[model samples]
Target: MTLASLDRISPRKGRLSHTTVFWMVFAVIMALLVIAPFVLPVFWLKFLTEILIWGLLAMSSDLLLGYTGLISFGHSVFFGLGMYGAAGALLHSHPANLWLAILCGLAGAGGAALFVAYFSTRLRDVYFAITTLIFAQIFYVIIFTWTSVTGGENGLIFSRPHFAIPFLVDFKFDRYTMHWFVLALVAGSYVLLRRITRSPFGMVLQSIRENEARTRAIGYPVDRYKIVAVMLSGLFAGLAGVLYAVQNEFAAPDFVFFITSGDTIIFNVMGGIGTLVGPIVGAGFFQLLRELLSRLFGDQFPYLIPVGMVFIVMIIFLPQGLMGWARRWLNQ
Candidate 1:
């Protein structure tokens, strides 16, 4: 069915449709995160941090692909750019400054997103995807070649900086502190994105996504709306990148590579596109599967096989994704 038809089908209205259940689930997750540091092994906690970062990336992409209905193949450009931007700040600064690095990265990625969206949003569907992909590849090449700034193919490595707030909190970038930081950041991001998606402006973006022609006919400046949506997505993706760099203590050209974009797409599709939380769930599942399979099968058996199998099973059994299926079941 066309997106237009899909847009026309409304769920049966009822009090059960309220967001109370959603909040309850969110609260439970938060509580678990609060306890995770105590319960989970340090190594595993680090893995979980990676999951949160990737989940954020997946969620950011969902803003464009899931909500705005714009599938950007080059979404990782912002992610990689943010990593390099933040890494650069941290490396060059005398006194390690976390906030400054994050802000620099965010600004760099946001600016790049606006510039790319200005041109790319004019295209639609496959054309738009290709344009974004090309841009991303170009960025990857630039990062690869720029040894002075990006550390070339070797990438840039730096110790995670201390939070510069001397007066109130002395936050260190150790594994334990970072894991909690990631959890808090992910929670905050989810709440912010949820609010954005529920806003009137977000509704307009969905309308555009469902049928750009119809939305434009009704008086919305379709291109501008799309640009803004992409920018917002870029901002979040950038934030995810900064977190990734801090957690890994490195930034590489691979961060901006096409594969990164592809992986995020898989995360969104597997998790259930259009469901904001689904992407995070999907990221966690995917990462856990990879980690487990790698250990179980060893180097002889490629973990990708099991990973692929799980995604296939998910597609065949829960095509709408775990969260999507859950929502349907609950609403029913």
Candidate 2:
């Protein structure tokens, strides 16, 4: 089939999947999440909160890797910067500025993304990935060595904020409240992203991912689109970082380390790239698996073997990951 014929066959001008039931399922899930903290044990509540944060990180990375055809191995830089941004605001600058801290984290990460994308957009494939990785490493080094504000090896610790939102409900970031807060953030982020992905801009991004040269030839500014997408991804990662810092009540250099980036990749790929909800599910499953494995073998290293096995199995049987596989199955 010719390219034009294929294009005609696949129309990109519609709302995402006219399946009301699919959306309703998500609504139900959100309702469950609302009540989850009440029933879940303390450990599970904390674990799931971590999953939500990681899920946001995975979703952000997938926005570039899956939708924009950008492979960035150092996406965790934004997440780490976000942690520091919030920590710096709460600890060093303004103790009671909750919104300001969150904004600072988001702005810092978004600004960093623009800087990285400016140079990284010129490259493609492995070069793009490596460049991002190098930049991330540089940020990690800076954070690790900046002992004055960051506390270097010791990491920075701070109390959770008790911000009072005007007109809206005011709450403290205790374990229970924080769990619900993260849940709301994750759900809202997912909904916002889903809307974006179904909009015209998102369609253009998919086109760029499918054929960048063709998209550029068709009068689209591919580079500019990529930068915007990366910025959005970074902002989302930063938001996740804010939540991460709040949950742990600490900010560590390890949040920006290369391994953290690698974990997001694993979460995205294992959950099914391109499907936003997949990353959340994948993160939850990964965390649960790690918990189970650690309990079974009495160490975290044994979890590696199972993770490797899962990766190999997915590659051999379901290359597209869990969500992708589920999609294919449902369609069939």
Candidate 3:
């Protein structure tokens, strides 16, 4: 073969190898996680489950910040609404139907997303971020002050719903079962989001991220796209919240606070924005760091100081994030 043809074929082969390696590694990690519940102690199992839930939340934020170029500080609103919606259904319903509770959570999150997107999408840059922050604070205040409805800072606890598939399968979620359930949901979400980020619609989102004016001039409805993206992001965030409420057996107002949204953004940044899997990795890493630090230092030590130092170092040395660095190394 000619040198030119050989060179082209070599690059293609290299790309294929990289892709294959990635999938192989991914499969192995998933297999390990599947078996983890059986081997790990109860405390570690619960901790890992918490990480997966938070990872899902981080992935939701990545949809907006990484894909849509929208910095949202009101994701906590959707999450909080979802939690409350599930809580209300479980507490008030006669049977505490699981599917119905999930639907309620989705409805609450979807509605809030539409409401926030209507006004927030019109603004750009930091103004949009500020608007979302304000909206989150507003919702937090409402949830906290509405004594009779929201439990007035005390939050509401509910019994766990049974996992059922009509007449086919029905069971309560023990620690192991709960971990498996959460893992399944999270894996499904990652697959869906990965598909989304690789689709034609995802291309347009990246274009919008790069240059909104050009995308609009090319005949795309930028505003409509942004609103849809926000809603999609919210849907997943709400799902994460529902899972969290189910795991914890309670819904609290603290989660609705803007700080929660900020932490999600940090996860995106730390993991490498625009990569769907990055945020999940970031969540796992951050949580592990916190757990380790807390154990070593005890309650008296301000762990955030060390965590902040590590974060600063990461920003300075690995600005593209952990996943980004891995990608670069693989390519090299």
Q: Candidate 1 lDDT, tens digit per residue, 191-249?
A: 99988987889889889888999999999999999899889999999999999998888
Cα displacement (Å) at residue 109, model 2: 0.7
| TM-score of every prediction relative to native | 0.93, 0.93, 0.94
lDDT of each: 0.86, 0.83, 0.88
Pick the lDDT winner. Answer: 3
TM-score of 3: 0.94
lDDT of 2 by residue, 1-332 (tens): 23322322365643255346668888898888878889999988898789999999999888888778888876789998899898888886544577877988898898889888888887888898899999999988988998987899778899887766878867776767888889888889998987788688998988998898999999999889988998999999999999898778899998899888888888888898888888887788788888888887887466788878987887789777788787767656
> Which one wins by TM-score: 2 or 3?
3
Candidate 2 or 1, higher lDDT: 1
| Model 3 pairs whose backbones collide | none
lDDT of 3 by residue, 106-130 (tens): 8999899999989999888899899
Once superposed on the true structure, which residue ranges of model 2 sit more than 4 Å away at CA?
1-17, 167-169
211 in model 2: Cα distance from truth in Å?
0.8
Off by over 4 Å in 1: 1-17
**Candidate 1 local accuracy as lDDT?**
0.86
